[model samples]
Target chain A: MILYLMCFALFLVGVYGLLTKRDLIKLILSIAVMGYAVNLFLILFAYKKDAGIPILLEGVVQGSMVDPLPQALVLTSIVIELGTTALLVALAIRLVQKYKTFDITKIRRLFG
Target chain B: MPVETWLYFTLGFMILGSIIALEIKDILSSIVAIGVVGLGVSVAFLFLQAPDLAIVQFLFEIFAMIILVRAFVKKDYHAETPARVNGFLVAISMLVIIAIFVSSISVFKLLPPFGQPLFETAQHYVDHGVRETGAVNLVTAIILDYRAYDTLGEVTVLFTAILGTITILRIRNGKNAGRKGA
Candidate 1:
């Protein structure tokens, strides 16, 4: 309840930053923040009360294991995030070379 | 408290941290904040019992941070002026919309309990997945065999993105080359 609200708020804050911020780096950070918020929401979706670790070992009780699917998805998403960040940074570098300043307002060579 | 409660708390913290990251003004600070957000999300994945996801996320964060840092080092750091907008109204409207959407969804009752037919089906695949698909990882079996076309599309998208990025970043040959050719 409260947790979900918090997540939503966080996501909104990131969105606001991404939309309003002129700095390319801040925009990237906002996007990353949004990604993290979504990931957190997904993980929260899988949680179960009193669920034990998913691993099955000797003498371990059955029927109390947590869901493993979300974890796997999160791992993949993390990798994807890494790739995105790398690409974004590469683009930012190129943009910087073309334009001397990091101020995005001054680097508006591609305005529609 | 139950593990679920703790997980929820962690999620809350992650959300808070992400919000802060987004709002920060400094570029380097924002990058670091984003990295922290990624770490928090990875931790959340661990709590969800997705060890594989956690591992992948950890690796991704490292690569992303490195790339961002490199870019910052290669470029000049400057503060950007804030864009003007009706922030209060937008925030209010967005919050209202989100509240309505979330409340309508009823996520609590959307999915059935664990070990349902879906799990049984997934488990069946896990049991004999390797025999049919020759893949050790059950997730891989589902991804590669069951969703082969989807995977192909994804690969195509990746290739396209790479090509686009390269094209966008291509450097033009200077007047020296032109003079030499003349």
Candidate 2:
């Protein structure tokens, strides 16, 4: 479907930026973009047309709700992503403070 | 208008935002572009009847926005020298990427069609989640009751991440504060 293709293209655009970008923050942003694209694709892929929310509301019929599995998976992944982004940003702060630069190629002083 | 048509339109906007986010030179502008992409995706999630994901995504965008703002100093982070990326290498990489995506699409054809539950176990949860877990939301029942162990691990990861951040930043007791006091 065009929708799926478009999402994949967006993901590839993120990958392209990740490959080409020099700044660490930009690289991080690209990674997040890629993750977002994948998450969106997964949720949409699991979605059934005309399905309502997964909640069992009063008097609501069962078996007609959208899939809840992907929603739960996305929730957990989003939290994990928050942790990762936080850790990376902290590392970035340390890197910038120590090296006085954001270009990753220039900050290669972590020798054994 | 059909919801699928709306979904397509939103996906197009999201794609546009994604391209802009990656292509723009300014970091601040790039941040805004990514935010727009997130918003568009969240809207699409809602359209697909995943309100929980939509809410989480909406909040996640805010969280990411805060992180970007926190990192947003006026310092010049731009690399003065242009990157020497080889055109031929990039072309090859793109080709490989396209191949992977195409293969994935073909494999997706093997998956259960949209809206159908793939597993019988999941169907049981869908039917009796509220009565069993006492949670009205099926997602809550799944994550909290059926997959409780996974949730526990997720919490542990979150805790460890907070610890790692603190360790990296040393916001708490600095290295050898006890020794100095002694």
Candidate 3:
């Protein structure tokens, strides 16, 4: 219960950073933080007390094991996050080249 | 110590690292701080009995750190002015966030209690996963066999992201191309 709240708090911190930060790099960092929170949440859900990893071993009884579903989901999500982060970094690099600044506030020509 | 204690500690470190990452004045230091947080999450994954996730997370964190450091090196700006955030807006947003978090706690109560997951199809996966997929590791079985479509979608997403990155970065700016070597 408390753990879940803590995860949510971490997520809110990311959201706060996303809302308040002006730097493009910081924005990307916040997105990464949010992704971490979500991945942690799913892993927490799959956990079981005293359970072994989700693998079937020979000569060992299948007594108890953590859920494999969420683990699979998180696996896919982690790779997807990697791809997005690369894409975002590429975009940020282009932005820096064009504007000569990492600060988002200075790149307001689109608002005009 | 119980696993919960270790989990609490890891989560605390992650939260603290996240705060430091966001509040740090130096962008490079902030990137390092975020990397620590990512590693902490990977540790938490190991503690939760998900070695597969822990391994993937470890690799992902390394690659992510490399990319972030490269971005920092390529950055044009040397002077980082402290973020000038509006105090009033921060306060309002904090209050709203607190309210939403409190409300969500009630929703979380509907979820299964810690360490006691309510399994439906997951039970079937555990019982028949090895026989159906011939994979000893149920997670691998799920990813590569039962839920193969998800893997396909993930691969497609990676392809698209790579394509987009290549396309965005390959553009030769007419004016800046002469000044800056791209």
Candidate 4:
């Protein structure tokens, strides 16, 4: 489907940035982008046509709900992404402090 | 507009924002652009019938933006790293990899087409999850009850990350702290 391919494109965009970008902050953002793409893909998988949210409510048919398992898994993943972003940012700050530059290429200690 | 239309719009917005974020020279602009992508994803979550995820995503976007902004404040605003590898070569290689990936996936037909989910396990949860777990929201039930151990592990990972961040920031540089006679 178009959605799946678009999601894959989003993921590839992240990969391209990760591979090509040199700034530490850009690398962090690329990682976050990849996380978003993956989370969206999982949510897309859980969707059902015309299904309500997966909360049991009065007068609402239980069967007419989207899958909840992936939602729960994605919740965990989102939190994990947050923690990862925080840690990466913290590491970036320390690297900046030690090396005096955001460019990874400039951070090398032993120059030929 | 229909929900699908709006969803597509948001997805396109996210893709555009990500591209802008990466291509822009200004670090602050890049951060704000990625924030837009995150907010658009939160909106997509709502359209996809996941309010809980929407809320979490909204909160996450706010927090992530705050952290990134705080970290970047008063720091170098513009950084342009010249490409060490040829841009054209990277592009061609990526295209080849993507083509291979797409062809393999299409030949295999790995995923069920968009709307049709394989819900064999989910059916049991939807039927008896509320009665068994006493949680109206099946997602909450699964997270808090059925997968409590997993939740515990998630919390532990978060805690460790925060603790590491604090430890990394708190320690003084070895050079700054004069060493005692060895």
Candidate 5:
């Protein structure tokens, strides 16, 4: 319960950074931080106390194994995060190339 | 150590790392701090009993760090954006946090407790996974067999992202060549 709130606070930190940061790279990094915080929160949903791994070892007692579904979901999400981050950084690079700076305030062609 | 204790500690580490990453003016410090946050979250995943996720996270963190480093090589070390502290931004942020807090409290009341019953789909796969899919790991069977379509979609997403990146970057290269030729 408390852990979930902590994750939420972490997410808000990312959000605050996103809203406040004027640098393109910093914005990109903030988005990534938000993604990580969400992933951690999702992992909490499937956690079980005294749980073992979700593998099917031969003759191994399958007692209270942690839920594997969220793990699977998170696996795909992590890869997706990589893709999005790359795309954002690529866009940021192009922005810098065009504007000669990383500051969003200076890259005002799109704003007005 | 108690599980709660570990969870709290991991969360604290992650919060601290992220704050540092976002708050710092130095670009290099921001990158390193974000990596620390990533590793801290990976550790939290481990404590949450998801070794596969931890591994994937650790690997992906490496990938992100490598790309970021490459990107940073040509870019300046310091963020030149001046910090702004407008009341509107602060108000919106406070409102969002409050909304999240309220909604989360209500949602927690409606949902089942920490341990949900075994999902029948997962249970079926777990019990007969080895015999049916010939994969000793149930997670492998679940991903490769039971949810093969989902995996295919994930692969498609990766391909699309890669294609987009190549197209975008290739344009810049083409423009550079045109300049050189001119």
Candidate 6:
């Protein structure tokens, strides 16, 4: 499908950003982009046509219900993303403090 | 025309957007592009009948963008020098590999089809799991009870990461507290 291909292209773009970008902040941003792309791909995999909400109500049953599993998984994944972003921000702050600049080239203290 | 045609077009666009996001020189622009990718993905999820995942992906995508922007405020967004590599070759090779991988999987139908026997077993687990484990969500029941050991290991790994971060961030004074008294 055109939509699936578009999603894949977006994911590849994010990957390219993460791999090619030299700026530390940009690198982090690219990585986040990559994460978003993958998450999107996963969500897209579970879509269905003409499905109603997954929630069950009394006395009225839906003929077709949306899949609920992916939603729960996505919620957990979002929390994980939050944790990762927090750590990334903390690392960026420390990198700035130590190097006095955001340029990745100047911050070569870690390289052997 | 069949709906499949539109789906194919959207898929192509999604792929194009991903490539652009990665290739772009501007970090901020790439971040925005990533957001677009997320939106596209959520829409795809809706089409796939996975509303739950779509909602979660939407929420996480927004959160990630905000975090990236906040971290890079007043910070340099470009690399002074690019890494030395045969870019074209690498890209070509990667594309080939991905094509091969995708084609192989699709051609062979490697993934288990939905509602197969395996899925039935999984469904059974979900149906009876909560009653046995006292967990409300079927997935949660599986994660917390059926495969508890794996969850425990993951928790340990998380704790280790936190500990490492704390240790790295700790400030070392000139004199140790015990030696200061001596």
Best by DockQ: 3
lDDT of 2 by residue, B1-182 (tens): 87778888998888788777766777778888888988898898889888888898899889988887666545453522356756886787678878888887876677676555464445677777877889999898889998989899999998999789878876423554554221
Candidate closer to the true structure by lDDT (higher is better), 1 or 4: 4
lDDT (Cα, tens digit) per residue for candidate 2, span A1-112: 6666777887887888787677788888888889888998888777776778889788866657777887888889888887888888888876776677777888888952
How close to the true structure is residue B158 of candidate 5, measured as C-alpha lDDT? 86
In model 5, what is the error at residue A15, expressed in angstroms?
A: 1.7
Model 3 lDDT tens row, B1-182:
88999999999999999999998888788888999999999999999999999999999999999998876754453535666767988898889888999999998888888998776579889989888889999999999999999999999999999899888888878765666443
**Per-residue lDDT value at B159 in model 4:** 97
By TM-score, the best candidate is 3
Off by over 4 Å in 2: A59-63, B74-89, B102-105, B112-120, B171-182
**Candidate 2 positional error at B1, Å:** 2.3
Candidate 4 per-residue lDDT, tens place, B1-182, comes to: 76667777888889899989988988888999999999989999999999999999999999999999888756665555554756786787588758865785674367887778876688888888978999999999999999999999999999999998888877667686663311
Could you tell me the lDDT of residue B171 within candidate 6? 41
lDDT tens readout by residue for model 6, A18-77: 554556666665666566566654555444455554444457754544344554555555
- lDDT (10s digit) by residue, model 1, range B25-88: 6666767777777777677666666566677777778877877776684455644555665678
In terms of lDDT, model 6 sits at: 0.58
Give the Cα error of residue B83 in candidate 3, in Å: 4.5
Write the candidate numbers in order of decreasing lDDT: 3, 4, 5, 2, 1, 6
Candidate 3's residue-wise lDDT over A73-107, tens digit each?
99999999999999999998888877878889898
TM-score of chain B of 4: 0.85
Report the Cα interface RMSD of each model, rounded to 1 decimal.
4.2, 2.1, 1.0, 1.6, 1.9, 4.8
Which digits, one per residue and each the tens of the lDDT, describe model 6 over residues B88-161?
Answer: 86687578657854764454354333222122234455446546877644545555677667566656655655
Residue B121 accuracy (lDDT) in model 6:
33
Query: Which consecutive 10 residues in model 4 chain A have the weakest lDDT in total?
Result: A103-112
Residue A59 Cα positional deviation in candidate 3, in Å, after optimal superposition: 3.4
Q: Compute each candidate's TM-score over C-alphas.
A: 0.72, 0.87, 0.95, 0.91, 0.90, 0.64
C-alpha lDDT (0 to 100) for residue B122 of candidate 3 = 90
Instruction: Please provide, for model 4 over A10-70, each residue's C-alpha lDDT reduced to its tens digit, 9 standing for 90 to 100.
Output: 8878988888788899999999999999999899877888889999788865558899999
Each predicted complex: what DockQ?
0.36, 0.61, 0.83, 0.69, 0.64, 0.33
Q: For model 5, what is the C-alpha lDDT against the true structure?
A: 0.79
